[model samples]
Target: MIDIRDFHVRYGNNHVVRGIDLAVAKGECVGIVGESGCGKSTLLRCLVGLEHGWQGHVAIDGKPVGQRRTHEELARVQMVFQDPFGSLHPRHRIGRALSEPARCMGLPHGRDRIATALEEVGLPAAFADRFPHELSGGQRQRVAIARALIVEPPVVLLDEPTSALDVSVQAEILNLLSDRRDERELTYVLVSHDLSVVAHMCDRVLVMQEGCFVDQLTPEDIGAGRASHPYARHLIAASFPDAA
Candidate 1:
């Protein structure tokens, strides 16, 4: 549902994402894996229209995305950012936050839709009335997911959605995301630094380096053999500290 070709993003004079070409099919989950400062988050921000001033092409489905589109058109693509605390409004109730997208789109607002969305994200219906500060980190993240999913966008960009939580909480969130994607038949482009998390969630993986894609592999590649790219191998080694 998304295609990027020869994409390059620059902040001031420095290019953060360099000549990236990627395609994500409908209902598919793709993971972009890299170390810190590898431009994964920058690329995702560009897709979501947060970062402009890039060169080359970024197409969602078939329409190009940038600052040129209407707000409603851009709302078709939603993002779940890494930090729930920072992404959500402390003053806004969960229900208001979850309903804002639909309201912005001029769609009919209903309590049933809000309840369903919260339930789909593994939160109780009553939690919708609570403020962001009242929820735990994981719960807040789940509310963030609900906010993103309530729109029922064709593509959801997940930028380190579970990176801040504990391992058990991370696993629960991952499983919830996986189940929701399957149940909703949603397309996801997930950015993560954790190789194990990527391996568990993604069907295919792209390994990024510096500012470009260095390797693309299936889960089988990680299971059966070593990654061919030096940086990919290095990342794998670091993921298992005993091997290093």
Candidate 2:
């Protein structure tokens, strides 16, 4: 459902994402694993039209993403950002954040839709009336997920979806995401620095370094410690010290 070819992004003179070519089929969960500054998130932002300096072809659901995307086009792919607290305004209630996407897309914005989104993320419908500050870190992230789902997008790009939460909370969020993907038949391109998280959630994992993917690992390869590239091996070792 998503395709990119020869994609490159630069900030001034510094090249961030260089020559990224990838394709994600419908209902597939693909993971991009790399350390910070390796350009995983930069590549992701480019796909969603957050970065304008990118050069290449990006098509989501057969629609080429340009410098500016209309509300309807953007609703085709939703992004769940790294920071949930910053993503949501301090003053706005959870309901407002969830409904804002529907409002922008001219879709029906009502309590039932918002409440269903909240419940889908394991949050009660009543939490919609509460503010972001009133919730814990996990609760805040759940709200972020709800907001992403409120648009009913086919593809969701997750940037470190569980980085800020505690371990138990992270497991909960990952399980919730897996369940939602099955229930909604959603496609996901998950970006994270954790190989274990990628292994647990993704069907295929792309190992990125220096703004390019050095190797790709499937579940079988990861399980057998068969990463071919040096950087990929190092990442797998770091994620599993005892196994290393």
Candidate 3:
């Protein structure tokens, strides 16, 4: 559903994402794993139009991104950012936040859609009336997920969706995301630094380093001890210290 070819993103003279070529098929969950400063987040931002001033071809469902499309055109590709607290509005109630996206998209706006989104994210209906600060970290993240899913976009770019939560809460959110993907048949490009998380959530994994894709591995590579790239081995070793 998404294709990026020879994508290069730079800030002044410092290039962050260099020559990234990747494709994500419909209903496929592709994980991009790398350490901090590897440009994983930058690539996600560029794909969703948050970062401009880059050179590359990013196409979603055969339509090219950037000046070729309007804001509404880009809405088809939504993003779920890492930080739930910063992503949501402090003053607006959860209901309003969830409804605003649909309203912006000119879709139907009512309790039914909002309720369904909340339930789909494993959130209680009553929480909709509360503000973001009033909810726990997990609830806030769920609200963020609900907000993204409300648009019913075919592809969602998740930027470290579980990084901010505790392990148990992260598991819940991961399961929730997995269930949503299966039920809705949504395609995802998940950016994470955790190899184990990617192992559990993604069908295929892309290892990135210094702003480029260094290796691509299937779950079987991880299972059969076949990831042999230097950086891939480093990541695997760091992920399983006892085994190393």
Candidate 4:
């Protein structure tokens, strides 16, 4: 469902993402893991149309998308950012935020759609009347998920989705995402530094370093500490220090 070729992103003279080529199939979850400044998130930004300066060929759902996208094209792909609070408007009510996308797309049944979206994320419909500040981090993240799903997009890009939440709540959010994917048959591109999260949620893991894909592994490889690439081995070892 997603194809990227020879992708490169530059900030002035410094190149952050270099020659990336990747393909993600429909209904499959792919995880990208790397250290800070490795351009993992930058790649996502380019895919979701947040960053326009990237140079590459990117095709989503078999259609090439330029820097400018139509509402229909934009609605086909959605993103759940790292920080829910930061992504959501501080003043907007949850219902308003949830309805905006559909409203912009001229989709009907806004009220019923908002209720269903909240329920799908394990949130009470009553919460729609509340603000972002009124909800817990987990709740806010669920609302973020709901907002992304309300548009009924085929592709969702998650960037460090559970990193900001408490550890106890992290599993719940991840499980919710997993369940949603199974129920909806959605395609996901998950970006996370946590191997445990990647292993739990992704079918394939791509190891990125210095803005390039150095190795790829399955969840089983992560559990067995079997990686051929030096950086992949280092990452696995670091994540499992007891085994290392």
Best by TM-score: 4
Residue-by-residue lDDT tens digits, candidate 1, 101-159: 88887765578888988998889999879999999999999999998888778889999
Q: Write the per-residue lDDT of candidate 3 for residues 1-244, one digit (tens) a residue.
A: 9988999988998999898899899999999999899999998887777878789888888777773457566677789999999999999999999999899888876988888888888787877799999998999999998888888889888999989988988999899899999988999999998877888899999999999999898877765555768898788778876543
Model 2 Cα lDDT, one tens digit per residue, 1-244: 9999999888999999898899999999999998889999988787776878889888998778886888877888889898889999999999999898889988878999888888889889999899999999899999998888888899999999999888988999999999999999999999998888888999999999999989999977776777889888888787776554
Segments in model 2 whose C-alpha atoms lie over 4 Å from true places: none
Number of residue pairs clashing in candidate 1, backbone atoms closer than 3 angstroms, sequence gap of 3 or more or interchain = 0
Give Cα-based local distance difference scores for all models.
0.86, 0.89, 0.87, 0.93
- What's the true lDDT of residue 94 in model 3? 98
Candidate 1 error regions (>4 Å): 241-244
| TM-score of predicted structure 2 | 0.97
The lDDT, on a scale of 0 to 1, for candidate 3 is 0.87
Error of 3 at 86 (Å): 1.3
Candidates 1 and 2, the one with greater lDDT: 2
Of candidate 1, the 10-residue stretch with the lowest lDDT total is 235-244
Residue 68 in model 2: lDDT: 83
Alpha-carbon TM-score of each model against the true structure: 0.94, 0.97, 0.95, 0.98
Instruction: Return the clash pairs for model 4, or none.
Output: none
